[model samples]
Target: MCVYVVDDDPRICRLLARLVGLEGFEVHTFEKAAMFLENLTRLKFGHVILDIDMPEHNGLDVLDHILHQKPYWPVIIISGSTAMDDAITAFRRGAIHFLRKPFRRDDLRAVLSEARKVGVKRIAAYELQARVMQVKLTGRETQVLDAMAGGLQSKMIAWKLGLSIRTVDMHRSNILAKLSARNSSQAVAIARGLGLTQ
Candidate 1:
């Protein structure tokens, strides 16, 4: 995966590029947020390491831009100063984590690991929403599939939905056919993979 480093400090940028690269990531360093936004579309994979202090446009503004554009792209905020307000703002703006400058490599690694896990879930949810639209699943069918996604058996689903087992089975079959899944497990697999289930 790629890692985009947005920091005005040349030394910090180079250091991060080298360190992240050593960890097997394709690294891209940007001196400013505008440049990153200009080429945001081409940045298709992985997360971003953003410095909270920058000239002209602050890191919070950049974070807002990123959130407005592609909300799924995980961002880790790094700052030289220990401003609790900034850290709080970053988190509220959807930053995965806020790291104080001169952070340890291990800490950064842990944050990245968590961010990637979140990114995968976001992607799955997005895919599931798209598939729901494409398949034209009714609200009732969606509820049944959601129950199945939670590993509920048809009879339980029927009871929960106040329907007959036969109706539940019919809904399950329709869900499987619409999703192009052969069996309950396959349908549930799609649901799980697409993050339809909690």
Candidate 2:
């Protein structure tokens, strides 16, 4: 995976590039938050190491933009500020980890390891969501599938949906065929796996 470092300090950026590179990740450095945001669409799957203090745009603003555009991307904050509020705000804004400036190599490594695992899960979830989107289901079929996932029988689902039992059964059969599942249980399982049902 790639590691994108956003810090205004050239020395710090170079140090982070070298350090992260040694860990076998491709490294990209940006001196400004605007540059990072502008190039976001071109970036590969990766985590970000961002410094809180920078000219033009601060880390928190950039963090907000990142989360807005790509909610699953992991962002690690590196700041010299010791203010507890900054750390709290960072976490509240969905930062994966916050490291104080002059942070130890071991601490960065640990967070990067954690971020890698998180990144993998996020990617898998995105892929599953994409696959789920490709499977077209009618509104009523979706309702039936959701009711099935909730462990509702055909009679119960029909009553809840204000539909006849035969209509509910037809929807169930269509859902099973569309999902390529043999039974209601298997259909529910597949729907959950594809993120179509909770």
Candidate 3:
């Protein structure tokens, strides 16, 4: 599996790169978020080992960036702060593991192994939850979401429901905004996780 090692600490970065490389996996290391972002799409990476703190862009920012584009890339954050709020924030951003610094190698490997097993391309949990909490739909939105879950388009949903395409589009927008989800996929992920959609 392809793994990205992003850290500001040179020694730590090198050590991780060496270790990950030795596992017969492809490893890419970056000292800054800008560097990582620059070449982010060069390959399809499986997991990211990110530091929670950096001079400019922290792990959260990078996490958002990844989700914005590469929505399926699971992250394992390495935090030296160990602040509860920080860990919570990182978890909210969909990180699989928030490991404190000075952690063992096996700890990181475990996180990576889990991420590789649970690859999400169709949905994310947080966006689904936000969608559920925000929408005030009385079965209509639920119906729309069910069709969406089946990969139906607005016109298709409208055709099936005997409603105009414009109405379906409006419902779609409301679903996106109400759930605070940035996109349809995110909304679906969150909605499904919340059990708002069957």
Local distance difference test, per candidate?
A: 0.86, 0.91, 0.79
Query: For residues 131-193, what per-residue lDDT tens digits would candidate 3 score against the true structure?
Result: 556567657777887888788999999999888999888888888877678988998886777
Tens-digit lDDT track for model 2 on 20-123?
Answer: 99888899999988989999977788999999888778789999998888888899999999999999999999999999999888888899999999999999
Model 2 segments beyond 4 Å from truth? 139-188, 195-198
Show the colliding residue pairs in model 3.
127-190, 128-190, 128-191, 129-190, 131-179
Residue pairs in collision within model 2 = none
Off by over 4 Å in 1: 138-177, 183-198
Q: In terms of lDDT, which candidate is strongest?
A: 2
- Top-scoring candidate (TM-score): 2
> What overall lDDT, based on C-alpha atoms, would model 2 receive against the true structure?
0.91
Q: What lDDT is reached at residue 184 by model 2?
A: 97
TM-score of each: 0.73, 0.77, 0.59
* Candidate 2: residue 186 lDDT (0-100): 94
Q: Give the range where candidate 1 is weakest over 10 consecutive residues by summed lDDT.
A: 189-198
